[model samples]
Target: MRIFVIDSDPSFQGATVNVTVLPYEPYWDETVEGNTTRYSGVNYNLLATLCQALNFTFRRIPTREWDEVAHLVEIRKSFMTTVIYGVLPERLQRWDFTFIFEHAGLYFAMPTPVIRPSWLSFYYPLGGYVWLAILVSTLAVCIALIQVMVNEDMEKVKNAMCTEQMQ
Candidate 1:
């Protein structure tokens, strides 16, 4: 990600605060395989911890104009650990956090796995049929009990009417 910061001096004596620009690079594994893989699979926590160790604050900028710059730029493969700047208090500044890329920009930043249609996880192997059969059987038994109760209630009502007519 490209970062730009400008510092201006309050006094207009033809003198400026001259700020040194520092670049920060965050690391993530490129070998992720599946779409279901969680974002935590990438070592983001470790990256944050490493940033804390260094005095510089880390911030993630959006990957804008990536399509135009991706071919021209070659991202460094080696891990970087360097310090550049004037000194500040250890506890004063905190690392700012943001998503590496926008949801649409993620496609350019990393190769995502193609999603596949989902099926029942339990419908695999021989043992799966046993559970299916058990569920069906339980449903059938409940249905049969309901029918029996209806029939018994109808028979009791018929018997009561017949006895009343004989009286």
Candidate 2:
């Protein structure tokens, strides 16, 4: 019952609030009939306590998914609820989120090398096309240098110059 309201009407102390929630796992979910949300997880559990403290009746409007809620919030929906973990810059621009119900830390699985360590790994970052381009360009530079050397001999100068100019 501890909901936070930011209205400048001192006369309005006790009023009902409609909050749309994005169903997420145990935090909040609908019973098979989609009539009411069953709250058990830490986020919704805390929300229950907050609602009690704030002394306001809340109406629940469940959204399809988190992505859908994100889109709705982007379009500036009238009411917002659910477990918002972080205050990202983009989210801040559209809405005013004032609650931090939980904190999620980053966790990434360490990649194991499928192939044993070898010097060949140096090319793993480059795509096949890039390697092919490098090989062709190197070969082209070598051929041009050889042509320059052949042209210096005077005998093949006209042929090399013709090939170089293409005219």
Candidate 3:
């Protein structure tokens, strides 16, 4: 279990902000592999977005709380955890936002996470799919270009033969 500390921006003066944390299981999510892993949600973004939307400030604090999870064996005597600190204008507490957490590490800090729309869950596998499509498209274009060049050369040879025969 990771501990995320979320706070609203002080600039709001008296606005109350509602912050909710959602935990996700990384191992179970197939998107956790390769480039897709980057898009997965961590504790920090939830707070940051809320702060930004409310014109507040945010920070992330990581901590280890594996003991809090039920029936899980705490094999590691020590582990790292993270917390999100956000400051929002005091007026927006009425809006509700859900923050998601998956695995012990912060995915946002990593380079490979996919870019996703703010409202959608960061863990969606779109990045991997997009990358795969791009790779396939590039390969197909290369193959087509090679075929076009071969066809052009064959046409040149046919024209040369026809000219020689006419002469």
Cα deviation at 22, candidate 1, in Å, is 66
List the candidates' TM-scores in order.
0.24, 0.57, 0.26
Clashes of each: 0, 9, 27
User: Candidate 1 — which residues are off by over 4 angstroms?
Assistant: 1-126
When sorted by TM-score, best at the front, the candidate numbers are 2, 3, 1
Model 3: CA > 4 A from native: 1-126
Q: After superposition, how far is residue 166 of candidate 2 from its true place, in Å?
A: 32
Cα-based lDDT for every prediction: 0.42, 0.69, 0.47
Q: Candidate 2 at 10: error in angstroms?
A: 11
Per-model root-mean-square deviation over C-alphas: 16.9, 8.3, 20.7
lDDT of 3 by residue, 122-162 (tens): 44656888978988999999999999999999999999999
Q: Candidate 3: deviation at residue 45, Å?
A: 32
| RMSD (Cα, Å) of model 1 | 16.9
- Number of the candidate with higher lDDT, 2 or 3: 2
Which residue pairs in model 2 clash with each other? Answer: 1-49, 1-50, 1-51, 1-52, 1-53, 1-54, 2-50, 2-51, 2-54
TM-score of 1: 0.24
